[model samples]
Target: MPAAANLAVMDIPTPQEALRKLLLERLRPLVETPGRAQKPCGMQFRGTQLFSYCCFTTERIAAFETLQAVIGIVLNGTKEFWVGNSGRRFSAGQVFVLPAGTKLDVVNIPDDRRGRYEALIVEVHHLPPALAALPELPQPAARETRHDVTLTAELVDALSHAAHTLASSDHAEILAEHRLAEVLMLLRNDPAARCLFDLSLRERIARMVVAETTRTWTAEAIAAKLGMGASTLRRHLTQDGTALREVLATARMQIARGMLERGEANVSTAAEAAGYASRSHFIRRYRSIYGAVPSEHLAR
Candidate 1:
């Protein structure tokens, strides 16, 4: 069959249909039985192949768990996923891994009411027999950690180009296999990489503080909420190579920068929304940390 001119631009009405289309397009050659129907609003990527698609809705428990072993990238929107039987939440930016056979539930909360839950889901089943023969796949960490990693525009562009290339060329499958391995390696090597699937209560609370960048948070307050002592909280953050305040500041700045880039807020508004009491303070701090003023940074 001939490929659609704008195959990547189609607005699949439902998540199930979208997954179905994606499988038919990307994984038809790998699976023995490729014509099976997916559960309502969901699709399966069978066998050993790489498949990618954008999801546009809040996914429930059953729906989310369907892609249990897949690794996904968050182009936009927040996804709250769980690992194992733990009751904790994990939210990340840009790229993150969803452990194999891990039950994940995602909620897409956009700043704007009209915002849709958009993500690029990539599934790779083609591992060399030798690589696949490892005793066990990388399992989720026992404790969850929060990371602040830089996702440069160059990296995003590279991923987009790779995805486009995979969708268009006959060598798409081969290219995807290589690219997915590269991405996984990059993430595995990152010092800040955290396990999204196995977060603890304390870690979840800490993540919540980070996610709500607008709130003016204090160690004592956060500790109180988590039912931990300020000293204990410091100990936990110390293990992560930075203090609680630094992490909080970084999180706020990251959110502010994203909001400014998206034109969701202007300089002062972004600063204030990120919990800065004064515009001057925000600008000075932003410049010191990011090496550029808010306006200059946003202009790029």
Candidate 2:
């Protein structure tokens, strides 16, 4: 070979060849899955409890609280994430069940073969309206362990179909709502999925109120879902050392705080979503609970 050709071959480093190929291949699964036409890079979800979808993000999120009860699925890479007090390592194709207003400490979003931290997050604001008869919930025989580590395959499939048929943004929004509701319905009803849910009456009702923050919630309606009368429900909550109004207020503020942290909603938007008739009242209460005004979260 000529001297120049020898130099050219030397200049091509072999060590990084695998990484280069891996980087290039990252663009392959742009859609949620195979046999579909999507660039995975730009897919977005909009809907009911599962609020929105995001492509991979490099943004570092530390000890930030989740806006509402949320369902997060990691499509690629590993995530060191926590919901409430449970801390565990989550791998790809795993699901996360974060409690409403749970402070999430995301240790990090790993950069790996799957590219940046790629996952889907849906904020749950509303659960299905109560059925006339709830299934007979099993009493706790021992300590009930919360489970966030569940298979993400079914969830990934449902979300994939939802995104594949996304027409308009408006349509996308509607699609998310029904599909998420469907998923929640399935989780609530599936005997096998019982461990993945938080079954405490207060916690369950609190999640429901947070999911439907904009609507006026009544104790009677919540009581119906739990298969009890309003007075009995109140008595139960009282025994649990909480009240219906307290749960609503806490859920609202936590939801607003999460929105503020992500810069997704303005102070006013958050207030409205949290069901405050007056922005001033929202601001005062937000500061009292979260230790800052809503807008301050963005600045922080």
Candidate 3:
């Protein structure tokens, strides 16, 4: 067997597990150089050569520089990233690719005063020239464009699954290379995929805010947590056509409704769980948005 093939089937059981374990092992030798953050579940490993992490934390400032390419998926939460001379923001259900030699920084902002945010990060050595040589992607002129390419959920799920599979070792380098190629092909067809090859700053803030009517948060507190001046944050979001408060309310109501439908919690419980301080307040918002009372909606 080829050396990589031999390494592939060695002692691993499932393909997914083997790939992840092997990556962890390989990364073990490189932890000292560039440094690594704590790994979240589903992230196989971190090493000097390659690293991945998933984070859901209160708003804070973070910065890093890499000599390698980085691809990130924002599964749930908003991230504003600064790359070299450009900056871009991404929200839940979005994906971003950063080229090698890019200086990157991210800050998470919560529409509600809750200060909760999350994202996934994946970094690999520079894309091979062969990969970069694929046909150029067309995008709106940077001067007129405001949003980065939005990746479909299907593509995101596929990439996530592939990354999980790669964490296992059942495949040889050829197989691994093929899987990576598949991901590149998907990006090639996506309008937003060009950003992966050429590094640029893209900014995206949430179009909607989600807040619990019952929970009260001071503007100063919210502004400080997001690392933005209160006035500035409000102005930007307002210009987007929705007030921050409206976004927060919509988000919380959606969560409440989902919980109620799942039968995981009753009206009162679901309301509070969704960040309402009082059942009455929750019910009021719920009725206003859904045209039915929380209990009535749950009954169905």
Candidate 4:
């Protein structure tokens, strides 16, 4: 892969490609100076569809969590998946089906060959029309809401192909939708997967926040739009372990990071979209979350 500025869609990294590069970078890690972005890895995301993308991991990480339902494919290496005190180890080719707001601790064990741990994770935003219209998934004798999903061989293959082609394909979003549709097919057949689709109102609010990052949203305003009182909405978010501001920032950061990763916008434009009046402020916050200022992508 060339410098990010020189690399077009053709040079974007697939999951496997990402893993390889991450390992190589680790051998000669770039030093991160204060107030400057780290050296850019050729690890560009192909698109901002929000429904799909690839993620690269090179070191051990823990306390991984987010507010999006994700379908994750383990491209290489085994990783420990911990839900509370109980823990389990899963290896390459296994899939992680996690509902929104579920918290899991993960520790990556790099494969000796690649020296990287990679997973391509696709976030499920609003329910696609296909899944929304789907009847509830089947139920076992003992019923419970599902929090995680198991991967099947067919799903693994489809998602692997999606990651492989995503970096080079012009139709990244389309490929993602196709893969997501396959996920929906799986969900339709499995009651456990479908149960994750019972997205909570708090999650709904979070999606709305993500969708409308530019809007100056307050709890009162959101409640008004949702036909509820401000205090009630606050209580709901509190129960979900978030607040109006936190949700707003989380949503804005996702969109902002996507815009930067796809090379869709410079830092200034992304700042505006994130509802910040100051580019410097946005950069500081962006660096805090992403470990780099956004503009550094072009410098690479």
Candidate 5:
């Protein structure tokens, strides 16, 4: 072959290819020998927003709601999402951003040829100071909206670097937050990215509850912290077709679910972290919301 043909044939991997390779190399060991770590489904950086998701079987987890906005990159399988009546499928190397408080059904299907699925997920909760300084931020609709993003090379590299940093460094929270901010900036122009700037009342309350799950949160206390009257807050939430109890329950369940997924805590520990003084109460509530007890869930 000519020199030019040889150079073209030996070209370096693209950003998408690089990301796929990076995730597979790092997460393959964890998936193969799950007992080596506490993780059963995937690995999570406790203090950071980064996490890995792996699945060998096709299971549809229905009505999975996002307590916080998240961005996910599919590395080794097809992730199918059903939001309301609409359905969409994202394949390997694709990215999707879901707004906070959105409810959807999701299924993880391993790659037909590879026989395994892996992905990287990052929760976007911290709004950068500069972005929050904007005077007029766009408000998303009360209903859920999905942002199917076309990742640029810069974005792909940012995600790859974040995964590497979190996986290798013991003290990576500050750096991880900075990297998360970079991700938000990259997708700033996209409509879905506005969730970080302009949050709805329900989502705002959810974020607060999730931040301090152990707190004995009451409507009056939450209202006082938000600088609003208790009655007024209740009125607004009522208008939104929810109440303080519902919000608190959902937020607590989200924390408990996260703890269980990480596999670092037992059911009792998760229950306490979720502010449930009674383990029985926590199990009943979890079953009502997630359709299974935490123990049964862990078995999966």
Candidate 6:
């Protein structure tokens, strides 16, 4: 077949594309108004799983540090990302997976027709039991990269069901988890998303701590939460070369830094948001990690 003919043939909307259209339509009620706020805004689904609706009125570039792994689907417009030194682009009908603790900048460009950029950001904290029980994935080299994959019908359907159930009932957490699990299981089979499946113990703990940054987390408490002995959890984290204290600090700092950057809170407010009681202590710790006071972010 001729190249032009192939393009014509492929231009037809796949079943996935059709379902994505319906999903976006169903989500319109929950969509935030563009330009109302600079920060991403949306709803939280199940525990630690967030399905945020991000809408930007104008072309905007922002830096983000992920505290948990995210699966983002662009519902409108396009996104260009720079991870480390590599660049990648994804438009409507595409999916991108970012691992926990990744620092990257992205430019969100609205399509001329829509005049706004829209996307759904799903924070995936941990794999479901079915996926977790599978064979462990090989650890890749220490490099920052984003996984790009074609959005599938199964994922769209799962999201649609999850959204509908949440909107209709007060007790929808269990049903929503099963639906989102289907979404994750689909991603697990994709080669590009294999990195997401290999979240380290340190990363998993980091994700959990960040969810409730205000809590005073002890090793025993965290271990009990994870269904393991305190000493055993400590040993495993030690093998990963990160201690519980360090992980907790890193997670809290990330939250404070993010809030400051978004202009949502001042140093004192951000410190409290990150679970700090004393302003001076938060400032000292912030300076130690970022080499600047929390006030510096406010200055921007």
Candidate achieving the largest lDDT = 5
Residue-by-residue lDDT tens digits, candidate 2, 1-300 = 667775534455353343333322332243245564533443244333333333455554566765566666565566675556767765555556765555667754545664655656656555555421446566566764545433334544554554333323556565766666556655664443453354577677767775555667899988876678999989999999999888877877777776776567888989987879899999998888878777788623
Better of 3 and 6 by lDDT: 6
Off by over 4 Å in 6: 1-11, 14-29, 32-63, 128-135, 138-146, 164-169, 172-176, 212-216, 224-228, 257-266, 273-275, 295-300
lDDT of 5 by residue, 172-259 (tens): 7657766766777787766645556567677777777776666788889888767689999999999999998888878877887877
Candidate 3 displacement at residue 226 in angstroms = 44
- Positional deviation of residue 161's Cα in model 1 after best superposition, in angstroms: 3.8
lDDT per model vs. reference: 0.51, 0.60, 0.52, 0.60, 0.72, 0.70
Query: Sort by TM-score, best first: what order?
Result: 6, 5, 2, 4, 3, 1
lDDT of 1 by residue, 136-217 (tens): 3356555446433334444444445455545555677566656655544444434444343234433444455544455668
Q: What is the overall TM-score of model 1 with all chains considered together?
A: 0.37
- In model 1, the runs with Cα more than 4 Å from the true position are 1-59, 66-68, 83-93, 110-114, 126-144, 147-158, 191-300
Per-candidate RMSD vs. true structure?
19.5, 9.7, 18.8, 13.6, 5.5, 5.5
Regarding TM-score, does 2 or 5 come out ahead? 5
Top candidate (TM-score): 6
Model 5 lDDT on a 0 to 1 scale: 0.72
TM-score of 6: 0.73
Please give, for residues 212-255, the per-residue lDDT of candidate 6 as tens digits: 56677899987876678999999999998888888877877887
Tens-digit lDDT string for candidate 4 (1-300): 548878556666566444444432332121122674332232333333322222235444466655456665555566676777877665555555666656678776667775555555556665655665556544467764443344455654555454544444577656666666675676555555654566666666666666455677788887876668999998988888887788777677767766765567888888987878998898899889767678764323
CA lDDT, candidate 2, residue 198:
48
Worst window of 10 by summed lDDT in candidate 1: 38-47
